[model samples]
Target chain A: MFFNMQLTYEIAGGDFGKAGYASSEIKKVLKKLNLDLRIIKKIAVALYEAEVNIVAHAYRGSLTVEIDTVKISVKAQDEGPGIADIDQAMTEGFSTASAQVREMGFGAGMGLPNIKKNADELNISSEVGKGTELEIITYLK
Target chain B: MEAQTFHHALTILTDVCIGCTHCMQVCPTEALRVKNGKAELFDNRCVDCGECMRVCPVNAIIVEQDDFSEIFKYKYRVALVPSVFIGQFPRDIPTRGIYSALLEQGFTHVYEAEHSAELLRESINEYITEYEDKWPVISTFCPAVVRLIQVRFPSLLDHMMQLKPPLDLAAMSYKKHLIDKGHNSDDIGIFYVTPCAAKIAAVKSPVGDESSPINGVINLNFLFNKTYRTLKNNDREQCPIPEKEQLKDFEMTWTLTSGESTHVNRRSLAIDGIHNVIEFLEKLENGEVTNFKFLELRACDESCAGGILTVENRFLTRDRLHNRAKQYLKDVSEGKRLHNKSIDQYKPYLKQHINIKSIPARSMLKLDEDMGEAMKKMERVRNLMCFLPAIDCGACGAPSCQSLAEDIVQKRAAISGCVFIQQSMQMKNKLSNDHALRIMEKTWGENRFDKDCTKKGAKDES
Candidate 1:
């Protein structure tokens, strides 16, 4: 029989050091579930990039994750200047992160694209001045 | 191996990780992550390169090497020495002096790995020259680097040089040497004098398509004291050379990262230390530089001299090796001749490979389709983190406030598991049940915890 878990993380912004918080927690949850290795990795990559985005751009954010017998789902919402051009931001080479973030070895512009590649289904909604919300789904079956 | 099987390999000190993600940031395999205020290591994905062990500021991560007592079970012990051993001692000390010392220390046979290293070097260059169309021919000298490439950049497996590691090459060559003298292979136990713990782990559980040719590992530090005593005595017989031309020293020079660059007979870029190597290789994976035909990478800074397990100072070791290499090359022709002879007599050891498949990492995601419970847990995590100071000091029973919150939410831990949170609760006289309910109510908002969320019920009284 398969089991399900729901996890949550309150990611604080303005901290470059604590960037991958939500993603790391999700990885721990997946490990305990004994999901397929491939699916676990995909969820981890997508969720982590999303978390980093919130910390880098938002003032504060929260991550909500849902896991079941055959599938995993994640939703990240942040209070920040939402993405102006969703298509451009999703592009592999498009990045808006500052020089400081790059020095720490992040802001590679590959974050969004990598997230896209890892998730089975991904949705992003943003209103330039409002905020940003991301939803991701990955299936193990 | 499954993640469940390797669970014991995960070591989270809880207090010292600082949640910096330095290990996670640099891990080529993406086996680490920072949650809350501490770093968590994934067991299934970790290859145990000791990068975390080396980079941690508080010495929180630890990867221990197997003891020499493992060698006691074997009847015939053969010592396989890497070429870098030449960089360890003074130039005046005869190389065979070290060999004789190993004999006194219970090893039955000694082989200078540089002989195989030279042979492997020549073979790799020839392979590169023949397959010149293969743009970047990655060196196979560092087992840890090979693991990184295989795990993080699987598509670039074609870029790796087909040759086995020098120690493996030397072990196979020695097995053949013993066979020619009418000895059985199983009777002789081959032990590599390793520069790092990765090599020891590699010997125990090798990656990729090959099994380790050597049976065991002996760190340089463990063997140094005894060998040094022998160097002072100047007593035992010299190493039995199969050929008179094999004893020349330059063949032993490839101990450092740049050591292979010199032997490759071409312009090559050498990188040592973990962070720099990861960056350059990532660039390579992205096809950043196409012109550089050869690249030598080492995980430790100062090449092998700065290895994770070495006892000597890396800077001092580098200077000593540089000075000694200069003094040994007085006769350039002899150096070239010695290098050529070692190559002509090379042997390959091929063994049955045991697949070490990757395992899934544990998820911190929700256990049910209940968003209501997840929201409640998020609120709990938020409250804990606010009280956390974000120092990730790891004093809490969990790795971080985030981790503690996950535990609390999942019923694996409690909010009071956080010492800081508990202390704050005590200071405010809010450790009572009513205050705990109030803390939850305030963080999650009034309508936050629905009947669906309370389906699991509250397990922690606090």
Candidate 2:
């Protein structure tokens, strides 16, 4: 059987207190649906890292989650200074976060790598003066 | 699979409840709900933290404990005293004096829970040294914290220390001692003097152990008045106090928070209070907290001393216990002949491995029993929530606008239950009615209707 549902959440930048609220809510929804624990943990990790990236680096962002029987697809679009070099940004230990952001024990250049490790498919597109958008999908089967 | 046993030590008196949301809001597990002017507990979700009992203004919630009278049925009665119980009294009172008092109250033998804690600590140290892979081994001493992990963080089960609690160890040890002295096992009854309701529930229906070695649990608050009287009336001032080696400073400190982490000589952190514990566990789950060999998480603020059933202030008691521990160490340094045994001589009483199982979700937030139906309802609820005011005013008798939307999707409530929706609908009806009246007046003048009505009436009269 196949089913689908979508949820959207707005993420405000520098709101550290509510950074993971969206991911946690989605995790609760998935748990109630009786999904496997391993699958839920993987998706939660990837989604949380993506959500935190928006809060730490972007001015403001929005997350649209598409959930179906076989997979969960997440798209995060942010209105912030976009990445200049996609290949370099994808590399571990490379970051363009501010000093204040790094002081908060984030922006270790591990966010994208961690997300890629958990997600089955990841796509990134950015405009230097415009904004950045990321799409992540993890299979539930 | 065998059916799991459910035990709840909390009871609510409905008549005294004011339908206040204090308990509902403070519950860490969201196990409580106010329905129809009364508080109801979702038994499977409650961790028996007793936070509701502490927050209730009218004392409507009560902890259920085994009666002391039940101990009389056995030929011999053993009292397993948690170290926190000693902190309830004044510092001037000798530790041996309390043991003598318990014996005076008809206990065949009195055993300190700290002794068992010391044994468990040794075993854990050895276990950690051997299994270095499990760096962050969470302590399993606090029953409430253990249950919280079982319910909320099932993925972290492998990190929990696989050992029985100190009270269970003490009960098993005393039982063996009596049996060795030619006493029948059936004739002896072991009762733990507990500081919290969680321990009572833990003993009755334990999550890890196959069955609890302890027979019954008695609340310390219930025994305080009687023990206080016994301590005052006993006149043994002339008798020489028995000299016994007290537990090490580290062992005695187990009654309070951060004691285990500091004593174990490892990289560790201790978190206390249910809210703080929950927060820390979330961080750990998110991979934010690392590099610690152990994590001591207690549900109560100041560990067992801060339990709801405890009478004295946790800080003052902690100070008194620290002073007693210092005195104990001083006596040991002076070469006094105090009866103390080596750690190697003591064997584990747990005997069998304790298996902790994850609790299945109750799915209270799910809209239906079936996953597909629940997903459909969730979509509808989300759409309905967008139209709500989102003020969370509670005027509709639900806690929040989101909850009202959920209720509507569940068919337990109607959208009109919202005051704003009802007002808008009434306004629309009034405006439409006025519009219909205007159209009638425009099509037919008011005087024409009056003349037609008069002519029809005259014809009927003729």
Q: Tens digit of lDDT per residue, candidate 1, span B1-462?
A: 111122322255765444454565555455665545456655544655677667676656644434676666667777777645545776576555666667777777677776665566667677678767655777767766766655454445666766566676667767766776777777778888877766766677665534777877777766776678766886545543323334344454576767777667666788887668766664554333457777787778887788766666787777766665565566554554344443344333322211122321123233334443444455566565666666554444344556555566667655664556766887788797555545444433343345543222345422
Give the per-residue lDDT of model 2 (tens digit) for B369-423: 6667778878888789878899875545455777778778878666765666656
Stretches of candidate 1 off by over 4 Å are A1-141, B1-47, B50-76, B122-140, B144-163, B235-251, B260-270, B277-297, B322-329, B332-343, B346-387, B397-414, B430-462
Query: How well does candidate 2 match the true structure in TM-score terms?
Result: 0.83
C-alpha RMSD over true interface residues, each candidate: 9.4, 2.6
lDDT of each: 0.63, 0.76
DockQ of each: 0.05, 0.36
**C-alpha positional error of residue B421 in candidate 1 after TM-score superposition, expressed in Å:** 1.0
Which runs in model 2 stand beyond 4 Å of their true positions? A14-18, A94-107, B1-7, B129-135, B235-245, B341-344, B348-370, B387-462
lDDT of 2 at B142: 94
User: TM-score: which candidate is best?
Assistant: 2
Candidate 2 per-residue lDDT, tens place, A70-123, comes to 778999999998999988898987778788888897568988888898889999
